[model samples]
Each structure stands twice: as C-alpha cells, then as structure tokens.
Target: MTAAPSLDSKYYEAARPRSLGERLTGAARQRIHADFLRLCRPGPETTILDVGVSDVINDAANGLERHYPYPHRITAVGLGAAEAFRAAFPSVAYRQVAADCRLPFADGSFGIATSNAVLEHVGSPENQRLLLAEMARVARTVFVTVPHRFFPVEHHTAIPLLHYTDAGFRWACRRLGKEEWAQQQNLILMSRRRLAALVPPGRTARLGRTGLPLGPFSSNLFLLLTP
Candidate 1:
C-alpha cells in the first residue's frame, strides 16, 4: 500500500493501552466473525476480499486478520496507511484504496467480499449505495456491516441518544469536542430502513442484526446479499 507516513497518525497505531470502547468493539467483532464463518462456510482455498479494513493496531481491530486460519487468501483494501497491518499480517495483501472507495478489481474477483463498519464513513446515502453495488459487482457473495443508529451509544463518538436526529447529532458532536465526527462525510447514523434502501435492484438482500438484539434497537446491522 502507498500510504504516506502521515496517514497512520490518525488511527490506533499501537497495541498497548487499548480503550474500553476498543475492547468492547473487538468482542463484538469476534461475534461478527463467527457469524461470517457460519454463513459463508468458506473452504481453505476460498479467497476473500475484505474491503475497508482498518489500520488500527489492535488484536481485535481486524477480526479476520487476527484469527483467520488462512491469512494468505485475504486481500484487504482501505484508504488510510496500513504499515502496521502489513507487519502484523504479512500473509494478507494490503492495498491502498482511493478516497472514492471503489474496488479496483474485475467482476467476481474473489469468492466473497466483505466490509465492516465502513458504510457510515463513505459520506452520503448515494455513496453508500455505490459501495454496495461495487462489492456486489466484484464478488458472488457480499457481506457488509454497519452500526445501528439506535444502539444507545454512537459507535464513532461513544455519545448517547443525542444522535437520534441528524441536526441534533451534528450539533452535539461539535459541542462535545467530536468535531471530526460531526461532519456527515466523516460519520452518519444508519437505521434499518436507511440500510435496506441501499442495496441495488434485483439483489436478494437479507438484512440481520448482531451484537445485541433488542428488536428494532440492535447494536449492529449486517447485509448478506447475492445477485
């Protein structure tokens, strides 16, 4: 990946001193990983393309990288620098994706394609739809995940119910010193209806909840789609 030295400054580039949020997030991801394996049932030779992998230096940050039995079969792409990720999982091929969030591969490039907690960061609803289309374009099976808006605590800022509305959430984020997350392009809350509309036409999209199941108020949302 051609990430500049400056790019790694923003994310968690260290292993020690992990926060409670990161720890909990990691545990949730482990559950997601289990679900992924169960649903996909990938064989040893099955290659997976993991879109929008984080460069955060934590054991729990990239769940598949930390525990996957076949690391070499994974190809990960992201916008930020991944020097630490490369060092940690040398078997996985890491690529620097552009800000447009397009996957640079042909149709059916991998057996399966996946992205975790990245839809919110891609800007608008239109952009989110495009991401879904691209992932579907490049793989036979697509699995994507995003945080639920009603999760009680906002995943990015860790604030409570102030994020129930768009205007109020932005205002509160600025007041609470989370100015970065205030920007819609940086972070936007997602609901069940919002996520359901993102899948392109003709695809059989099966939406599910994970982390905690509280009917409409779940901790996370996942999409398992097929063309």
Candidate 2:
C-alpha cells in the first residue's frame, strides 16, 4: 500500500493571499464558519476535536481553530507536534498521535469534530472511511471539507481539466513541470457522491459546495454530519 504523503509536502502549503485559489479558499472559510456556527452552535463550553490539524507555519493552512468562536475549547490533533501552531495559538490545546492509529479520544467526547483538506491525503478509500467514522464516533456533530474532484483546476498541481478525466493525471503533472508534487503519492480527488456514500448509514448528513465564482462546481465540498 502507498504510504500517505507527508504533511510537509509543498502540495499542502498555504497559498499566498494574492493567489486566486487562496482568495477563494478565504471566502469559503467564511461560509464554512457560518455553517459550523449554525450546525454545531458551539458555545463557550463546547468541546471541539480537530483531527489531522495541519502543522504548516501558514495560518491559512491550519485548522478550524482560527475561525472558532472559542479557540480555547478546541483540542487540535496532528501526527506530530506543531511548534509553529503552538507559538501562534498559545491557548489552544494540541496533541500529537500516530497517523495510522485511531483517534485518542473516546466516543462522543466532543460537541464538534472537524478536519479540513486533510482527507484526500489519507492515502486510501478505507483510511478515508476510518477517518470519517472516527470523527462521527467522537463527536455529536462533524464538519469536514475536501477539494471537489470535478473542479476545473486541481488545487495541488494547479493543473487544469486533466484531474477529473485522466487516470494518468500524475504523469501529466510531471510532464507539465510539477515533478515534485507529482512524486507525492497520496492525493485522491473526491466527488460529492463518493463523499456521501462514505457516511455511515445512520448519520444524518448534508453536502454542499462553497468557494464561489464556481457555485456548485466550487473547488471544495463541505460536509456536515450529525448523530
């Protein structure tokens, strides 16, 4: 089995605010924050578990803690300690755990659980399912985000059109001078239908698009699941 790509890969780095993708992601973040507020209705006492938190130095690449109304209530988990994150958000709790193992928290331990843009890099469909199941198991409400497969521009490689139609997109990426990114093995583009199917049958869930100028064909898919 292919190992998951490292979180340090350039593919996961934050884009500059001036870049088109980052601008769109910033807009999407606002909508995501609003939806989370409405769906989870987090309060001062609410406990949030943010799984697979990005360790990137860039604030934009980090997790939902930045947007949460109560950052102190969030427990951010990552595969390794993120010194930069710790320095930036001194009040937020951070935990490090093995990437391949189950989440360290007990079932329904948090009022909200979230992960952003981390699912595609988990390496396989089975692992993706496990990640989602764990999120659902540990929180009464779950919010997750992933890049939409059919988006015209593939966010990671910044290549247009080929990601959806070509199985050889990786090769195409290398041919287009994105050799370094193409070498990283773990990105698996996902569609709304596939994401919906991944939810365990009993969970009540809704799926929608955010990051406009593309509307339903937006670059990201936002999923909310509740028990």
Candidate 3:
C-alpha cells in the first residue's frame, strides 16, 4: 500500500511572499507564541514536547521553538525528514513518529505539549482526537492552534467560503485543471464550538482569538488547556 504524505514532504511547502491574509495570520501567530509562553512558563529546565515540527522551508517563525525561550529543553516530533530537520536545528531534539499510531512517549514526560496549525492536517476528527489525547497524556498543559472555519479565506488554498461549504471542491479543482491542489484532502476546517468540544472535560481551557476583527470569527483559534 502507498504511504500517506508526510508533513515534512515537499507537498506541504509554500515558498512565496506572505499574502495579505497570511500577514494577518502571522499577526495572530505572534499572539499565540506569546500566550503559549505566558501560560506554559517554560524555563531552561522545563521539558517541552512539540508534537509537530514546522515547515522550515516556508516559514521559520511557524515553529514553537522560534518563540520558545529555551531551545535546549525542547523536543520536536514529526512524521518525516527527521535527519534533515535535526541537521538544520541541531540545538533541539527531533524524533520521528508514525502518523497513525500512539506517540512513543511516557505519561507526564514533559512539562508542556504544543502544536502549531497542525490539528486540521491530521486527516480526520478521530485522528485529531488521538493526537490531543496523546498530548494531554504526556504533559500537564497543552497548547494547540488550528485554522478557524469562520475565516473568510482558507489558508492552504487561499480560496474564500467555498472551501468550507463545498465538500467536492477538490474534485472540482481537478476538473478545472488544478490537479495539484486536488490532492490536499487532509485539511479539515474547524469551528470554535467544535474545537472547544474536543478539549477534555473539567480542564481549564482558555480560548484566544487572533487576526482580523470579528472576535470568534478570527482567522486563527488557539486552545490553551491547563490542569
């Protein structure tokens, strides 16, 4: 059987200048960085488990370690290109993991666990839940960020409204001679309510909004869950 596309594969790379929407998204990401640091309070001795590594070719600031104060204590996990990623960022530890299995880490192995704009690309809601549960199991606090469905334009395709409403959009793109984009089936747009429901019950979840001014309808959503 053919293997699924890895997160570090060239299929995910977008090497271009930031669009107006992307610049706005970047602003929101900055807020997420600050909030994660504030909430997690990482120190030189604090062990942080970063569930997904960022696209080093596209945006350098997209990774958690970019804003993280202590790089020596951060360990990043990814599903591909571990050698290249490790060589590029030698200071941080890198681990390769299977896409469909449990994370190979002990319970409470780290002080904090985090992922950036990674939830939507994990395939389905079930896979997303598995990732969340693993993150929670390995750390006392979890900080994750995913694209908000209410955002006017989808970050991956740069298409507005149609992506959220049209399930056959990828198929239509293929018919219209855009075959490359049609292969992106992993992205799943999520709403604030749906995102909130994914959090474990009784946990303190503070949802933060970032981007252009519609409040919850912002471009990105951040979920900060603490024990």
Top model number, lDDT = 1
lDDT of 3 by residue, 118-157 (tens): 7877776777877888888899889888778777766666
Clashing pairs in 2: none
- Of candidate 3, the 10-residue stretch with the lowest lDDT total is 1-10
Residue pairs that clash (backbone atoms under 3 angstroms), model 3: none
Name the top TM-score candidate. 1
What TM-score does model 1 achieve against the real structure? Answer: 0.90
Per-residue lDDT tens digits for candidate 1, residues 73-95, read 99999876687778888999988
Whole-model lDDT per candidate:
0.79, 0.73, 0.69
* lDDT tens digits, residue span 1-227, model 2: 11123545465443654676666666766776676777678889999987776555443565366766678899888776677677888888988877773688888899988877778777677888888888898999998888887878787777778877545677776688766454424677778987887886679999988644487678788889987
Candidate 2 CA-lDDT value:
0.73
Q: Give candidate 3 regions above 4 Å deviation.
A: 1-25, 166-185, 211-214
Q: Which sequence of candidate numbers ranks them by lDDT, best first?
A: 1, 2, 3
Error of 1 at 141 (Å): 0.4
Cα-lDDT of candidate 3: 0.69
Models 1 onward score TM values of: 0.90, 0.87, 0.82
Name every residue pair that clashes in candidate 1.
none
**TM value for model 2:** 0.87
TM-score-superior candidate, 1 or 3: 1
lDDT against true structure, model 1: 0.79
